[model samples]
Each structure stands twice: as structure tokens, then as C-alpha cells.
Target: MFVIDCPTHGSRVLLSERRIRALRNTDTGVLLALECYCGHVEKISTGRRAPARHVPE
Candidate 1:
């Protein structure tokens, strides 16, 4: 799961399952572009590298 902070809407949403479109590092932190099921797209910062996730087959 990841926290998405929407700049345009000035809101924060919790996304448990979603797709990450892109990832980029900037002076502030790590920027992640994500798409939600509700058709909302936004960019968010995690401050640091998100912990590695594992999935069971």
C-alpha cells in the first residue's frame, strides 16, 4: 500500500492496490506517478525509498 498526495485536489488518499506509472528522484524526495481505479492520476513523494514488497505466487 502507498499514500498518494494529490496536489491539484489538495487531498490525500490511501491506495492499497494500484499501478505505478513512473518513478523519479528529485531534490526533495522520490516522486511516484500513480493511477487509481477511480481514474484519478497524481504524483506523490515518499520522502525516501519505499520498502521492497514481495508477492506470493
Candidate 2:
């Protein structure tokens, strides 16, 4: 599970593994594609590194 800042929801959103569409490993962290309850898609990077900019689709 993971938590992300959802732009549409305007707060922290909880995401379960079932909500994950894709996951990619980066040199700094892991990139995750998550679907929100509102059906919004967002990409987030997580790990020991700094979080990347959120990409919404």
C-alpha cells in the first residue's frame, strides 16, 4: 500500500496494491502508476530519494 497526494482530491490518498496499474524501478526510487477512487491516474516516485513531480492523466 502507498499514500499519494491527489490533486483532484486535494489531500493524501491511500492506494492499495489492487489500485496499482504499473511499477517501474528507477535509480533513485520506484515509479508507480496509481488509480484514485475518482478514477484519476497519477504517477509517483517513492523511496529514499526525493519525490518526483506527479503526472496526472
Candidate 3:
């Protein structure tokens, strides 16, 4: 269970799998398809990645 912000319902609690519409893996994080009790659906990504640095020879 996690907390997600829903536009229609303000901050909402994701009770269980019931709130998960879909999920997939991303290069940097997991893409989450979340649904609020108000039926609002949104996508969120988990994890963070720093920008790649380029080195000049």
C-alpha cells in the first residue's frame, strides 16, 4: 500500500491491488498505473536517476 495524489480526490491511499490498474518496468523506475477511489487514473514512476555525464577526450 502506498499514498498517491489524485487530482479529483486530493491525496489518496492505495489500499491494495484494487487500486492498481496496470504496472510496467521502465529503464529508470517502475511505471505505475494507479486508480483513485474517484475513478481517476494516473501514471507515476518510482525511483530516480541522475543525468548522464559526457566526458570529452
Candidate 4:
């Protein structure tokens, strides 16, 4: 769970896993595509983790 300042909501909004549309790993952190209860889509990054490495077959 994470909190985001939604422009439409005008305050911190709680985002659950169910609200997540997609997740992507970046150099800095994880990018999350979330949809708010009011149908607003926003992207937020949280925490830093190493990016995944691909193993060639």
C-alpha cells in the first residue's frame, strides 16, 4: 500500500494493490501505474531496488 497526493482528490490518497494497473522497474525505483477511485490514472515511484537482469539462453 502507498499514499499519493491526487490532484483531483486534493490530499493523500491510499492506493492498494487492486488499484495498480501495471508495475515497471526503473533505475531509481519501481514505477506504478495506478487508477484512483475517481477513475484518475497516475504514476508514482517508491523505494529503490536493483533492476532485474536477463539471462540469455
Candidate 5:
């Protein structure tokens, strides 16, 4: 499962594996194609080379 900021849900949602549409390998990381409960599909990356997060200190 993975969490993404879903526009329909108006918050981050933990998507289940059943909603996953596809997966791909990239130089940066793993590409994940996931579907939100509202039927919105989004692709996100994960792994060591993925984009860095700018969290508030």
C-alpha cells in the first residue's frame, strides 16, 4: 500500500494494492501507478533516488 494526496478525498489516502494499475522501473526509483477510491489515478516514485522531501523543521 502507498499514501498519496488525493484531490477527491481532500487528504492523503492509503491506497490498497488492488488499486494499483501498473509499476515500472526507473533510474531514480520505482514508479507506482495507483488509483484513489474516487477513481483518480496518480503516479508516484519511491526508492533511494526518489525526489527529496522538504518537511518543515
Candidate 6:
């Protein structure tokens, strides 16, 4: 439900449901990877971007 623009790769990385649950449980605020528009990936934080558009399946 979150989107982040990768500085290294100009792609949209979308957060998955599993990642969302994991994030909610954790407190360390780690960076997790999500699928990109081009099928690539990048890591973003809960602090970096807010959950916006729904991630495509």
C-alpha cells in the first residue's frame, strides 16, 4: 500500500501485504524490498514514504 521512488533505479517499488504485516510487527524500522513497476525491486521505510496507492498484484 506504499510507494517509494528508488534513487538508484527510477522505478516505483510497491509494498506487499506480507511486508506490511511484518512492518507493523517490527519496531526497528528496517528497510524492506518491494516489487517495482519493471519487476525490479528497491527498499523503502515507513519513514521514507507514506502508504498511498494500492500495490498491484
Per-residue CA lDDT of model 5 for 1-57, tens digit only, reads 777788888888887899999899989998889999899998878879999765322
Error of 3 at 45 (Å): 0.3
lDDT of 6 by residue, 1-57 (tens): 766675456554555554433333245455566655555555545543445445443
Worst 10 residues of 3 by lDDT: 48-57
Between prediction 4 and prediction 6, the one with superior lDDT is 4
**Tens digits of per-residue lDDT for model 2 on 2-25?**
787787999889889999998888
Task: Write down the TM-score for model 5.
Answer: 0.76
Of candidate 5, the 10-residue stretch with the lowest lDDT total is 48-57
Model 2: residue 2 alpha-carbon error in angstroms? 0.7
Quickly count the clashes in candidate 1. Answer: 0
lDDT of 3 by residue, 5-57 (tens): 66686555555677889888768777778787788877777656523434222
Q: Candidate 4's C-alpha lDDT?
A: 0.77
What TM-score goes with each of the models?
0.49, 0.64, 0.64, 0.65, 0.76, 0.35
Count backbone clashes in candidate 3. 0
Clash number for every model?
0, 0, 0, 0, 0, 0
**What shift in Å separates residue 21 of candidate 5 from its native position after superposition?**
0.7
| Candidate scoring better on lDDT of 3 and 5 | 5
Measured on C-alpha atoms, candidate 1 has an lDDT of: 0.66
Error of 1 at 36 (Å): 0.4
The TM-score-based order of candidates, best leading, equals: 5, 4, 3, 2, 1, 6
Better of 4 and 5 by TM-score: 5
Per-residue CA lDDT of model 4 for 1-57, tens digit only, reads 866667899776888889999898878888888998888888766655745644222
Q: Provide the RMSD of all predictions against the true structure, rounded to 1 decimal.
A: 8.8, 5.0, 9.2, 10.5, 2.4, 7.6
Would you list the C-alpha lDDT of every candidate in the order shown?
0.66, 0.82, 0.69, 0.77, 0.84, 0.52
